[model samples]
Target: MSEQPVPVTTLLDDEAFLGTYQPDIWVFVQRSLIIGFLTAVVFGPLIGLPPEYWLPIMGFTTVFSAFIFDDYTSWLNHRADVWHLTSLRLIYENGNAPEQNAAVNLADIHATQRKLYKNLRLDLETGQSVLMKYLTNPRAIERDIDIARLALMGTIADEADIPTAEEANS
Candidate 1:
C-alpha cells in the first residue's frame, strides 16, 4: 500500500471522512454532544425567561462556542492519509481520494515520525506530515507504521518498481 498526501479541506467532504474507519468518530461526536449539552445547560432552562435572565445564557453559550466548538472545528479540519507500501516504494493517497498524490522510494525515506498530542500526527521521512485528529486510539496508528516499516525493509525492490540509487548515480 502507498501513502498519499491529501488537502486539509478534503475533510469537508463526507465521502472522505467516512472512507476510513477513523476511531475518532466517537470522540468528535462526543465532543459535539458535550458542547451542545453545555449550551443547553446554560441556556435551555432560561430561554423562556425574561431578556435579563436570558442574557446570562447567551453569554455562556457564546463562550462555549468560542472555546469548545473551536477545538471541534479544528479537529474537523484535520485529515489522515492511508499509505500503501509496495515492494520498492511507498504510495501515498488521501483517505478521501482515489488518485495518489505522490510516491517515495523506500531508500529516500530519512525517517518516520509520529506525534501524539490531542491528535495523531504521521510524519514521513520526507518532512511531510498528516494530522489525524480526535482519534480514540493513536497507538494503533503507530503500530501500523512500525509494521509497515519492517515489512518494507524485508521486501526486495524490483527494477520496474523503483529506480535504484546505483541507477540514479549512473
Candidate 2:
C-alpha cells in the first residue's frame, strides 16, 4: 500500500501556506523547572516540616509542580502561541481568544532580526515591532521571513535568485 501525503491547511483566503512556528519544547521545560523550583522554595519552609523531611518535601513538590505546570502551560499557553506563515501575511493566534489574534502583512515588514535567546523580532515599516519568543532555529526563520517579504514586495524576480538551503548554510 502507498502512503498518501497530508494536505496543507492555509489560514487565509488565497494565500499559500509556507510554514508554522511554535515555541520550542525546551522553553516549556525550562519554564516548568523554574516555576517548580521557585514554588518549592517558597512553600517548603512554610509547612514547618522537620529538617530531615525538608529535602524530600521540596523534591516531591518540585517534581509534582513541574509536571502540573508543564501540562498546564503546554495546553493553555504553548499550544495557542503559534505563528502561521502564509504567502501574504504572518498570522498570530494567542490562546483561545479571537480578539488577541493578529495578522501582519509581509509587505509592511521592514526587517526581521534574530534577537538573543530564541526570539525573532519583526520591525515594521511604521516603526512598530512584534516579538516572537522561544522559536526554534530563529536565525533560519528570520531568513525565511525576509525571503517571503522580498517575494511579496516584488524584489525576487526569479526562483534562481533565491538561495538554496545548502547555499544559505555555506
Candidate 3:
C-alpha cells in the first residue's frame, strides 16, 4: 500500500522557544459581532429620539461595546501560538504571533491527553503543557500529537530499550 501524505503544521509564537497549538477565537468574535449588529439595529435609530428612548440608548451602547470588544479580541486571537510534532520530537512555536517557546524530546514523553471544550488543552508527560482555549484549529493540533505518540512508540518497541537510567537510579 502507498503511504499517505503527511499534513503540514505551522509555527504560532515567538515569545516561547516552544509552544502548543491553540484554537482560534473566531466563534467568540462572530457572536460578539452579531450582538453588536443587533443592538445597532434595535437602538441606533432611536438614540436620536426623545430622552424617554432610554431603551434604545441602552441597546446602542451594548452594540458599541460588542463591536469594540469583539474586534480587539479577534485581532489578538489571530496571533495565537501553535504546537507541532515531528517524527522525533514535539515543538512549540508562534503560529503568527510571538510567544515564549520550548521543545521536548518525544523519547521523554510519557503520555498525552486531549481535553475538548470551549478551549482545547493538551496534557503532556513532559510536565510542560499549554492551555489554548481560544485557538482556532484544535483538531489539527491534537492530531499532530497523536501522530507523534505513535511514532515515539514505534521507535522504542522493546521495554529494555526504553530510557530508564535516570528514573531507575532515582
Candidate 4:
C-alpha cells in the first residue's frame, strides 16, 4: 500500500515491486513495420507506386503510426495494461482519468493459464477472468503472482517459490 520508485523502469500509485506484466515494446513496433512492409510489397504497385520508394515510406508510416497508437494506448494503460504489482494487490490503470483502474486482490485469484508468447489468463473467484497479454516474461510474472498469492494467504514463500537468482536479475 506504499509507493516505491523503481528508477527508470516503473511508476505506480502505491505499490511495491512484486513484479511487472508488460510485453517488449519493440515487439509491437516490429510487428507493425513488418505488416507495413508486406502491404507495400503487395499493394504499392497496384496503387502506381514503385516498390523501392514505397517500401520505406510505407514501412516508416506503419512504424510511426504504430508507435503513436502504441504510445497512446500505453499511456492510457500505463496505470493498468502493464501491471505493477504489490504484495496485497495487482494495480492497473487503463485510461486518461484517475478513476479508470482495475485492482485485483491477490486472494481473489483462483487459477491461471499461461500460453507461449507471454499470455496469462487469470481466473478469479468472482467468475471473471483477466488476461494479461504479450508479457515479455510470462514465467517470471507467474512466479511473482504465485508468491503474492502465498503472501496474501499469510504464508511466506521459500526460495523454491521464485525464479532463480540469475533469471530474476536479468
Candidate 5:
C-alpha cells in the first residue's frame, strides 16, 4: 500500500537530498530521428518546401516539434523530477504535472520490492504502492532504499542517504 504523501518541499537543497535525476535520453533521441525521417519523406513534399530544403525543414520541424511537444514533457519531467531520502520519509518527485508531486514517509513504506529487475515497487502502509520504472539502474536505488529502510528501522540514528548512480551509467 503505497499512496503518495503530500510534498513538504518542492526541490530540496539539503545535502541529504539525493538530488534530481534526469532519465536516460536515448528513447527521446531515437524518436526524434524517426520523426525527422518521416517528416522529410511525407511532410516535406506535401508542404512544397522544395527538395533541396527538405533536410533543413525536416531537421527544424523535428527539433521544433520535439522541444515544444515531446521534449517539453520529457524535459520538464526530467528537470522538475526529484527524489531523496530523509530520516522520516522516502521522497519521490515526478515533476509538476498540475502540481501532482507527492512524498511517501519512510515509516509508511511497509515493503519494497524490485520488479523485473529494473523497477522499484514501494508498498506503503495504505495498501497502495508506487512503482518507479525505467530507472537507469534500479539496483542502486533498491540498495539505497534498503539502507534507508534499515535506518528507519532504528538500525541507524543519523540521517540516511541514497547515492546517485553515476551519470554515465544512469
Candidate 6:
C-alpha cells in the first residue's frame, strides 16, 4: 500500500485567508530614482573634479545614493513589513521576529481611508489609527476592507438573493 501524505495545519488555519499586502515596488523605484538623480546633480560639481572625471563621479554618486537610501536604509526598514487580511482580523507583521506582530479584530475597525497616493489608514473604534504605507492600489484595498467589515457585521446580502447581470437587464 502506498503511504499517504499528512495534511499540514498552521495556527491561522481556522481563519479564512483573504489577502496579503506589502509595500509597492514602484515606491522603491521612485525613491531610488529621485534620490540618485538629486545626489548626482548636487554633489557632482561640488567635488570640483575635472570635466572628464565628472561623469564617472556622478554615476558613482548616483549608484551609491541608490544603494544607501533605497537598498540599505528603506529596504531594511520596510521590506519585512506586511499586512494580512483574514476572515476574523487584520494582522501586521514586522521583520522576522514573531514578537513584532499585531492583529486587530475586523469589528474594531471603524473606517479605512486612502491617504496620499499609496497609504492606508485604519481608524479603530478605540480612537487609535494604523497606517499602512506604500501599498499598491490602496483604493482597492480600502474597498475590500469595507466589504469584509460589512460582511462580518452581517450587512451584506446573500449571493443567492442577488440578481445576476442578465436577470437584472431582463
Question: Could you give candidate 1's per-residue lDDT for residues 1-170 as a string of tens digits?
Answer: 33333333322232222123243456665655566556666666656555456546655655577476585456544444444444344445555454545555555554444454435555666677655566666555444444444446765343244333354347
RMSD of 1: 13.2
Candidate 5: which pairs clash? 1-124, 1-127, 1-128, 2-124, 2-128, 2-129, 89-106
Model 2 lDDT per residue over 64-158, tens place: 76575465554356555778787899888765665777889999898777776677899999999998877768877887787887788787886
- Greater lDDT among 2 and 6 belongs to 2
Model 6 per-residue lDDT tens digits across residues 1-170: 32322212233657887777778667766655666566666766787655666556656766787675456566566766778787778888776565768888999999787886577899999999998877767877876776777678887676454333355448
**Which is superior by TM-score, 3 or 5?**
5
What is the descending lDDT order? 2, 6, 4, 5, 3, 1
lDDT for each candidate structure = 0.50, 0.71, 0.52, 0.65, 0.63, 0.71
Choose 1 or 5, whichever is better by lDDT. Answer: 5
Write down the TM-score for model 2.
0.59
The alpha-carbon RMSD values of the candidates against the true structure, listed in the order shown, are 13.2, 7.5, 11.6, 7.7, 10.1, 8.9
lDDT of 4 by residue, 23-46 (tens): 555555555666677767777888
Worst lDDT run of 10 residues, candidate 6, spans: 1-10
Q: Supply the TM-score for candidate 5.
A: 0.49
Instruction: Identify the candidate with maximal lDDT.
Output: 2
Q: After superposition, how far is residue 32 of candidate 4 from its true place, in Å?
A: 6.2
Top-TM-score structure, candidate number = 6
Greater lDDT among 1 and 2 belongs to 2
Task: List TM-score per model, in order.
Answer: 0.41, 0.59, 0.43, 0.54, 0.49, 0.61
